[model samples]
Target: MSTDPHANQFGELAWFKSSYSGTSGGDCVEVAATPAAVHVRDSKRPQAASLTISAEQWSAFAAYARQA
Candidate 1:
């Protein structure tokens, strides 16, 4: 088992699927916030790889997304 506390750590995470995510379950993205970082994953593949981005980076990404 991995020693990393954040590994396989989706449980209890307040995952919020993007507003753009439709009921058809296509192109769905989920985000979770942590004290030290922001976690992003695909809703269709919850157990798959996730992207761990720093809070600052996440904020920048969010700002960019808003403008896009």
Candidate 2:
């Protein structure tokens, strides 16, 4: 956990790509979840900024995406 929320809080987090993402992929996203927040970033740009959301928000998003 970091003192600054805007910072790359857990740069060492173990990021995982979506199962739907192919190795020959064009675009892909990766996610790293923590008890406090879920971090999302583009797999193509591993050094880029990550979008962080609350655990609750991540849960809601996952549910909605599954329905879609």
Candidate 3:
């Protein structure tokens, strides 16, 4: 992550909607990639706050989701 707190530092990340997102356009999460971390936010509110997680942590979370 860069010293800047703004996600804009990521420079136009290719955001992707989660596969589990409902087709009805309900609650959905989106994610974008940075060099060292993944940035996540709600698709309904792109201007809202986002959470940044380390690549390893994101991988662990994905693994846990698959297990569940």
For each candidate, the alpha-carbon lDDT, in order, equals 0.78, 0.81, 0.81
RMSD to the hidden true structure, all candidates: 3.6, 3.8, 3.9
Per-candidate count of clashing residue pairs (backbone under 3 Å): 0, 0, 0
Could you tell me the TM-score of candidate 3?
0.77
| Residue 2 in candidate 1, Cα distance off native in Å | 11
**Which stretches of candidate 2 lie above 4 Å from their native place?**
1-11
For 1-68, candidate 3 gives per-residue lDDT tens digits of: 64433346646667789687868999888998787899998888887788989999999999999999
lDDT of 1: 0.78
Model 1 lDDT, residue 61, Cα: 91
Instruction: List pairs with backbone clashes in candidate 1.
Output: none
lDDT of 1 by residue, 1-68 (tens): 65543354544567788666769978888888987789888888887777889999999998999999
Off by over 4 Å in 1: 1-11
The lDDT of model 3 is 0.81
Worst 10 residues of 2 by lDDT: 2-11
Give the TM-score (vs. native) of candidate 1: 0.75
Among the numbered candidates, top TM-score falls to: 2
Instruction: Give one digit per residue, the lDDT tens place, for model 2 in 1-68.
Output: 65443345445677899777878967888898887998898888877788989999999999999999
Q: What's the candidate order when arranged by decreasing TM-score?
A: 2, 3, 1
